[model samples]
Target: MSNLLKVIALLSLTVAAPGQSQADWQSHESILGAILEQVESNLRHTGEKYQIDVAPLDRRLQLPQCDRPLTVARLPGTRDLGNISVSVRCEGTQPWSLYGRAFVRLSKQVVALRTALRQGSLIAPGDVELVEKDATSLHGGFFNPEDVIGKPVRKSLAAGTVLLPTHLTTVKLVKRGQQVAIRAQNTVFEVSMAGIALTDGEAGQRIRVRNVSSQRIIEGQVISDGTISVSP
Candidate 1:
């Protein structure tokens, strides 16, 4: 074939190539949809404009609600959850959802439950289990302060208060010798050390403690002053 002809053919092929597009989220979208419905239910059922952000599907979820400006550049389905934005903020009904349904709120932010627990909110009600490592932020963009609010805003959380947001995957007690433990359910954790309960150890609180184990005062949460069990 003539070189000119070959060049023309290549150019034509390049132009004719099919372009790729975002995929549908499908059921994943449904879950998020449900969450949004919940928010609408609480938000007095009015559509509101909110922002939404999404993380890479593979990224581990850290926040409670999806980020703002939802994107689906990675997954399939125009309506699927695989490709959407996290950190979402939208305004519609108090709680809104597609077929999936979700709830949202304008005043209350859907932060990680772990963050709420840290803030000293009771983990009951409004708390939901994380489904997978790769999921949309939240189905809805708003929430009712009353329904989604954590336990009373604690000026400080006692050591024994259980930690939520299990993804707090990386927690290091700062004190060199402080003891630490994971408190859950309603049981008082066992004291793991004898070091001076650093930082006024109290009930349902995690404080920087010095670990008496190695005589190194390590930062630790005071599950319950001197009487609580410390996770070994």
Candidate 2:
């Protein structure tokens, strides 16, 4: 065959190659879709209703296509939810990698006040309610109501305000001048007596109590609400 004819044939064959046009370059949408899938999988345990918004890549930039499947992974130290970055990589013939920035929002039910509460007010079921909030913003959102029930507020809080550990105080189980059952017991025997709490205290806190029968004052640990246990 003539050299000119051979050159023309080779050029034609290259242009007609199957899947070549599709494989020549990578699209931004494909990369963003891969990132969304991976970020969703990683955040499955973080929350159920999760929203992901991957930022659009630079319009002028172009990336080589990969022959192998693309991979997405969270950047080191990336948070479970919030503005995060993921490593998007291609291990094909033309290896390439880049970071994709995305904003992740997760929703969850958190404890919130149903009514305004004053400082030192004890929490009750009627005073609080569950409200859906952005889990990413709630740092440590409380799910169970029992955690805050009966706990006193640290300061005045407005209605509809989310409840956090900083908003509540340790549950005071015993109160000063309140009648409490004083019990002293061992593995073999037990004795029960009536007493008056001399000071307010929380569970495991030691406070003075006066024996109602003997009129003797002694210190004991607050075991439960209206209950104190003493040792010999």
Which model scores highest in TM-score?
A: 2
lDDT, candidate 2, 1-232, per-residue tens? 2344234323322222355564576888898899888878877775368888888776644567668899888879998688887777777766677777788888888899999999999999999888889888785757888889888999999999899988988888999999999999999888889999999999899999999999999999999999999995
- Tens-place lDDT per residue, model 1, 3-118, is 44234323322121244222311234433544444333333543333333321121221112222332212122333333332222222222112111122223323333333344
In lDDT terms, how accurate is model 1?
A: 0.35
TM-score of each: 0.20, 0.74
Give me the displacement of residue 125 in model 2, in angstroms. 0.9
> How well does candidate 1 match the true structure in TM-score terms?
0.20
Residue 35's lDDT in candidate 2: 86
Compare the candidates by lDDT and give the number of the best one.
2
